[model samples]
Target: MNRYDHKGVSHYEFLERLHRWLNPRTYLEIGTLKGGTLRLASCPTICIDPEFQLDVSSAANREVTLFYQKTSDRFFQDHSPSALLNGPVDLGFLDGLHEAETLLRDFANLEKHCRSNSVIAIHDCIPMDVGQTTRINNGGLWTGDVWKVVPILKEYRPDISIFVFDAHPTGLVCCTNLDHGNTILDGMYGEIWRTWRSTELSDYGFSRLIEEANIISTSRVETPEEMRRYFWL
Candidate 1:
């Protein structure tokens, strides 16, 4: 039950032990820019943010509730009421408007107000395929087209279970296999998102995943020719 903030440490300690073993009632959070993960989430939070322009009175004095939909697909395509959702939110934190078609239409408009074991955490789905990088896709959580909505949610929800929680500069997908785990909190499920194939992204398979991500990003320092052969120590 630890939700440390300072904005880092992989999914806030497993999202605070899955929000204290799923004690959720409703806490949908698309992207509360300055709320710091909505004060490390607990419950009763609804922060949409379509250019919310902050100063929300310190996030409404910490009661944590604000919705300024400028375009969650035109507010759930005009179904309004912040998208006709008034129940069964439980947990859904996609870091808002991250391209790839608005993060796959905000997960198909929050998958119709999710519930049957609700918990959808998707943010910056790690996919920076080498250089030519141009960031600023804030609404697409920094492009990579939000990993193409995980194969459209595994071809229309095949009892989801994709994992990947690097938590660095925002990277977490965790869908959690619903069915085979028998839904909700049962055995406290955990397996965040993961899956790959697009002909394994060829072009010599993305030039060997960018040459193995540049040899694991230059395999740390301590030896870049021992500091370029000690330029003069």
Candidate 2:
């Protein structure tokens, strides 16, 4: 099995820099877990998680922070993101369910609440090894099959722009140029799931994915100005 050598900055550090560069008016995050990334947001923030292990008091940078202690699906079903934040999401980080189909659904739902320029970041899209790409998490450092979403988006939602960063541990996928009105992904969810649910990294060409992803180094955009230019912020 092939291994990905990611010597760039950690995802957390990259996200911190991203927050400063984007200076988003509103931020949304799924799978808050320990709130490591949630604390990075200094704007009006909405966090959804089935169970949160972090202390909310630590996110002192934000004046307005809303917490929904539930699954992303449940949160979306019960509330509109724009209504909750009083505007479309400026930046969103999706680190919820590790399954590709779940991530796809999360993307479809979240995009409807975003503007054309809004940025959405997906976690764990670049698995280091095939062992960590299994649908079920067997042990440490499991990314599940979330990497499949990269190709799925490339094939299905070609209108959007996707960029993969070589952040440590796994990788981060940032997507922009969104069309909230687009329903192609939602309409084709079943077919997409059927095609990708059983597929593995080896079968899909892991090396090809790494090569074609054109993963960018975090070191190149260490400063906010560099990030602004790279992402056209």
Candidate 3:
């Protein structure tokens, strides 16, 4: 029996696979945390976080990988992700504020810097349980309100394609069908926040979100080499 039948690949492995396939020159990640994820990129990387506890022990210390100690909100307001990249951001990760509203805002901002080939991955989309999705942030495996963005994107931005990798712990959502010129989300930002900003999911309701998201499990990847095929083919 395949181990992936009962378990998914770790998020780190999933990310590394994506980077290996994309071979992007620029990567921008929100929420640096301990630099565990940041270390995976051997390309130009920009990590933004208000507070980062970095550990570069077994990580790539690329001269191009930079840390911007600022909130995503401030970072976007003051700096351009593409400017740092000097072109479109090939790979962008939204692992910052776990709130749905914040995540939505980050997604919109990131989209402004994306080209047709861009893929932006949003983390913490799968909450462990009802308690884990709450805004209070109590549970050991809390996912916060980030899951709300799944359906929001599906409803408002039908042009975009959303896929969940279902990696270890929370999981990752990769978005394609990027439109740098799209302004629908920005226009409806307030209404979206009002709709999904304070969502609380029960056990049954949580399953519905998965159904609504139409997320693909990492088991679809089959093997590390197959990831490139899975994403592109």
Candidate 2 lDDT tens digits, 106-196: 9999999999889899889998888898777899999998998999999999999998999998988899999999999989999998888
- True-vs-predicted CA distance for residue 112, candidate 3, Å: 0.6
List model 3 lDDT by residue over 7-105, tens digit each: 468888888878877777788999989988888888888899999898774236565776789999999999988887788888888898888888999
Inter-residue clash pairs, candidate 3: none
- Model 1 per-residue lDDT at 224: 33
TM-score of each: 0.29, 0.96, 0.90
What is candidate 1's CA lDDT for residue 144?
Answer: 47
Range of the 10 consecutive residues with the lowest summed lDDT in candidate 3: 1-10
What lDDT does model 1 reach? 0.50
Predicted model with the maximum lDDT: 2
